[model samples]
Target: MVTSSSLVYLIGLPLFGAVFLLLMGRKADKWGHLFATAMSAGSFVLGLLHFFAMTNRSEEERPITQTLFTWIEAGDFKVDAALLLDQLSICFVLLISGVGTLIHIYSISYMSHDENRRRFFAYLNLFVASMLLLVLGNSYLNLYVGWEGVGLASYLLIGFWNQKPAYATASKKAFVMNRVGDMGLTIAIMIAFATMGTVSFDGVKEAVDRVGTPTLTAMGIMLLVAAAGKSAQFPLQAWLGDAMAGPTPVSALIHAATMVTAGVYLIVRSNFVFDAAPTAQLLVVIVGAITLIFGAIIGMAKDDIKKALAASTMSQIGYMIVAAGLGPAGYAFAIMHLLTHGFFKAGMFLGAGSVMHGMNDEVNMRKYGGLRKMMPITFATFGLGYLAIIGVPPFAGFYSKDEIIATAFNSGGAQGIILGSVTLLGAVITAFYMTRVMVLTFSGKPRWDDGVHPHESPALMWLPMALLAIGSVTAGYLFTQGEALVHWLSPLFAKKGEYDELMPHSVVTVLAITAVIIGVTAALMKYQFKSVDSVVPTDVSLATRLARNDLGQDVVNEALFMRPGQALTEGIVAIDERVVDGAVRGIGAMTVGSGATLRRTQSGYVRSYAALILLGALVLLAGIWVVTQ
Candidate 1:
């Protein structure tokens, strides 16, 4: 059973580690890696034990919940710091802890040279703890705490290189943009509480099921806003590409497993509300489909290795959102995709980090060529991730992405078909860009400037990449054919239904073959063995500029948010300096002038003062006597 006590360990251990790190100070450096790595690994192992133990329990025993204590108690209102253990929560627990441990190990080498290793690990641990709270919380309030915590951690990690102004700006952008989404989430929660009289998942779901369509629509849209900002969708997603200002491992976590996935978590958790609001569901599909294609196109044009990956992440997240809109079964695939995406995407980012490290911190793919010879492990691991992501056969990404696409086709109407089609195009684009990345970064020739030295990453860094690479290769099989994952996940989607009708082996095989042929052919004709002197453009036409600029969504946000924010700031400052402050200063000046005039009447002679005092006393006495009369 997931008692409040069980959750306490999930969150408290990392905090304890953070506290211990503070106590150890400099002495914690060498031991700090060991301690942090052990803590993360230990937490992961514990989570697995809990998951398996729950699986073995009776069906009635599976949904164990532990409420430690009441957090807020008001009239007919109470919120508990509760932890919920269910099939869904167990899945997330595994992903967070498993991926988290590997990233920690990788960081030991990647950030060993940093001045703030202690702070880095501290934030990292804190981030893990917060995400656990977010996923395991039984109430919306509990989730919000973790939601904000992750936001805080993101800001801290994104701006880890605080000396750089760009990094600081990127951090601010991320935090502020998320606040916009948080506001929507908060409002939705307040409405849910007022209407339903509770913020717990069961209460909200029951309430939403009874609420009117308008209310549901409003709530769903606000929830989408929250998800969009957190998951880096649409206009809100612009910040993520710039977020490459952080260290590479941080990028891996934010993009792959934790932060971006929070939005999906929120939507999936509130699937009941979304199910009731067809309009909101449509919006989700529209946003997801739009972002997917847009991100893919932008990714193609992107030359920076990390930025391209960031764009790719945004695009893939779109698929998940679309899946969520397709109904509960589709939502299950969304989560599945989320897990698989975390494996491969994180590997890809870490692999990029390794390349960056090897190439003396050069991230521009244009400068990296023929790196496969220098860093074979990175090339191979990252290549596996690329293949998996492009939905190649027998890879983890294909199963999830394909299910999402097929669901879109089945559940959605013509509009749904349109979203699916665009998504398919995005898949094609994703394949091309990723191939370009692998080829340009690791194949051809070394275009790095003179004096640049390159080599493989340390074992600590490479090991994580290797693990994720293996996962990328094998994780899909677990979903499609593996007994363990499916049986374990059965409870979560069993009630909704299965995609048995959709999973024709012949169809999947054809899709995989098609993806590989298109991906490989485009890469060969456009980049492979092509003279470096005459590089060919991958774009089929220039008409697709809308996708290049993220479908101009950023411009729309600037109009809707950026311009207004700027105008408001300027207007407030003008009023403060010219009107409000002027009025206050003017009052001060008038008071001073009155005081000067009053001083002028104050003569230095004692007789003058005495006469004035006598006159004032006589006037006061006369006024009192007249009143009495």
Candidate 2:
């Protein structure tokens, strides 16, 4: 590995922006957004240089490590505060910084009307820096530092408009749920130390063969818990939709492009560990399968444009996680999907933001229709993203997502079939909901209310979306050309995971396209031909209500986890009150009673003291006389 000090600048520029703007406060408000954007763009430029530099090097020389200082040093255990820019991490570095810079550009106008636009840029800078650190970390311990930084930054960004109670609650919800997942990562690191005697990625990889399967499995499961939480998978996923309470730029930048994708990075980064533990790997696939379907169902029922995209983000991430879970065979494909997803998902989110911007900050898709002519750029950009996500030919998602589905199907036995079928269903549901979003928002007649005028967002906002839309159109094809991305990423994994096809590539493509057609036709027939009620209907089918409520994820969380957790917390408090506090209170009461009794004996007079002393003397003399007689 090459050692280079230049690696720090990739993270430092944005980190500096965040710290500078925050410390300068109001004094920097006039130019804070511009400064922050420049910082992010600088990082992107640096990443591009590194990418080009890396391409010229041999496989062995591609990874560059920059060790800053010793992070931890204690008997037989040590960790370095360091960064690694390898082929895998470089992809993330570019994605985080590149997409991040665009989002920064978009937010310049998106947040212009807000009073705290400076602070908003500060948070955005912080988020970009933290995410850079996460992807760049040399060790799990180092990664955790970035992980917590990300959590903190996300909390601040999501709750930027904290005057609103709902937004505040949403941030708190994301924070608390993520903490629950964070614990899993912590435990996994500890397990790595105790069992493998190391927490660094290289160390862990080297030690994987030495450790028992159960140990590796435990570690992998813990890592999955962390991934699920960060990526908004399964039980930990409920917080993502509500996170739309933040600014629309936030949804695009953090939720769609950077932070949410961190989980996929984690799982794929720890590929060696999961590869050594089949049980854990299987569990990973299961979680992905469940969440993909789970999120897609919820997407089908959401009226809020941002929340609908949020659900799609969850499902798309599920596809990545499932690919990650497939071990070596699916690892590169997972990253491919992640990179393409960064473009399309981020674009769609910005598109949602653009729609909201033009429509007086209104978020309900039910009140939107026939916006294509009014906001032609937004429609075209968003339309490209839509095509990419649904696996339409030549778009970004078609190549990447198809690879995952094919990989899953070729995994063999019952597992392959189940995974393959689940992915197909997920794609169908994805198509249906995304089509619904496009139809409801841009295709039908305008559903405007009083005093609302639909118009295009300023170029400052749509420009970023337009760039990302181009990425959405071309990223997939570029990644798969001559199997470029997988070949580039191949050496990092322990094994080359290419497998013989269970089903021909042609057949899989045909099936996927057919599924898309079915989904699109269904959504068009169901939503496009019918008049959408401006308001959500209260009386609906049980399934529709369930989907609208995130497939009862919150209810399940409340009933099985939240209520039980709350009850447990209350019970613990009760126990503390009666047993722990009661004992202390009892001791206090005894002390007070004893003090009260002793207080009477201190009856304040010198006369009382003298009389008691005289009585004692008389008694002493009488006792002496009796003894003498």
Candidate 3:
């Protein structure tokens, strides 16, 4: 049932679109967005067909590979430019193409007024193509190609508005931070090649038993570092907030749905390595736990709408990472959360864009209020996404997030207890911050600037928002109620004995619900009926100040990494100029001085040269005679 060309078209079409748009240039500006959207939608349709084809086959036959060509061959090392279609990859393909199509459609209207609309769509297509390659590639080397492709595309998209200095700076920041993580991935690949003698998933998985625990642990940790960077976990999380400087649609597509989730995919994709190393797995959980709290705390204090959403994204990804770190027991739930998150978060981001569109592109939430009446569609759609994210009952986030919490409690031991507690706290804070965003942006008195007029966005923008909102409401139930996603992903993980929950599922659900209610109530009390000041106050509590400054992450980076790095670079530069360059120059100077002195003996007349040669011979002969005597 699997068509050989299916995977090729799925990845190639978007790449073709990107190339086409780039070649067409400004001439296609009038319709390039439409062409890009069609290409993206086509890929999604292909993915759907592939999914159906996969479903028709038995579970054992679900995974199929399509080899385009042999990519590398050196000694015993061999690689194929191939794609693998399995439950795991199919899920990502759907998420990437599905959400990607919507983002593309939204961009059509969102970027209509811009002069560089064609270029933007081209970058978007490139991004989709890169992501497809990333998820579909069968080997680590192949994945690396896609990985760097993604980085390149993101750099272009994030800095698309390069005329703005801040946007350019943000793009550089994201690029640099990701490089820090990419190094980890690079090392991980090298280790895989060195230890396992193979870089393919199947090869590595099979070699796990033969490989030493230390080597596996090192590889696992390095992979986690890579995941943390791409996924914006912990130390690498700082760039994501600043990344909000890009256009809103870019935020929705790259930050909310596809690019930021790359880290989670990498970790889950390499679950085999993590399974062999408990220490590395524990570190994954620790990073996830810390980041969830870190992002939530920051979200609570952010006033910029996009920055707040970016923080929320960080927090949400942290939750997924936590689940991923739990080993096979939690991988399914982690992916489920990621899928559900793609929908809701993308919806929220697009909705924010809609709000910005109406508010004359204002990003500060403090300047927004009571526009729910004016922009009813944006309000309704955004509210659905907000509800889903807060884990309100029957919403998508409820099923995915609650399962993660339940699984954490069931993981057993002190680690479980601590992680469960952290998850619960994160849920509460998630609800609080999300509720705060909703109330400030839509519920209270209008705080609009004097010249600003609020109105609903065109159907092109709201339609995608509406569809994503619908996904946010229903995806969790469909994926979780029947253990559907878990079963679907079973082949990727080993069968383990099911553990009983420490508390009843019902009790845990209630506890989570209670936290949500408290968070909602707190936000409603503070903002629902009140008027907010647009100007941020300088005087604030210590905690508020810390959160406002992003927990001093930049300061920490400056002190611990940036300043030290700068000093080291300066030292190296000095050495290059003063010592290295000086020594080279000194040699040149000695050669020049010697040449000048030797040139004096090169007289125009042959007699002058002959006389000098005779004198030199006589001196040499005399020295030889004296030595003999």
Top-scoring candidate (lDDT): 2
TM-scores vs. true structure, each candidate:
0.90, 0.94, 0.94
- The deviation in Å at residue 72 for candidate 1 is 0.6
Q: Any idea how many clashes model 3 has?
A: 0
| Superior by lDDT: candidate 1 or candidate 3 | 3
Distance (Å) between predicted and true CA of 119, model 3? 0.6
Stretches of model 3 off by over 4 angstroms after superposition:
1-3, 587-629
Cα lDDT tens digits for candidate 1, 60-171 = 6787788888899999999987888687887888889899999999999999899779878988887888888899889888999999999988999999997999899989
lDDT of 2 at 410: 92
Clashing residue pairs, backbone N/CA/C < 3 A, model 3? none
- Per-residue error at 571 for model 2, in Å? 3.2
- Per-model C-alpha lDDT, please? 0.83, 0.93, 0.92
Better of 2 and 3 by lDDT: 2
Report RMSD (Å) for each prediction in the order shown: 4.3, 2.7, 3.3
**Poorly placed runs, candidate 1 (over 4 Å):** 1-4, 482-505, 508-512, 533-556, 591-629
lDDT of 2: 0.93
Choose the strongest candidate by TM-score: 2
lDDT digits (tens) for residues 39-74 of candidate 3: 999999999998998899899889888999999889
Cα TM-score of candidate 1: 0.90
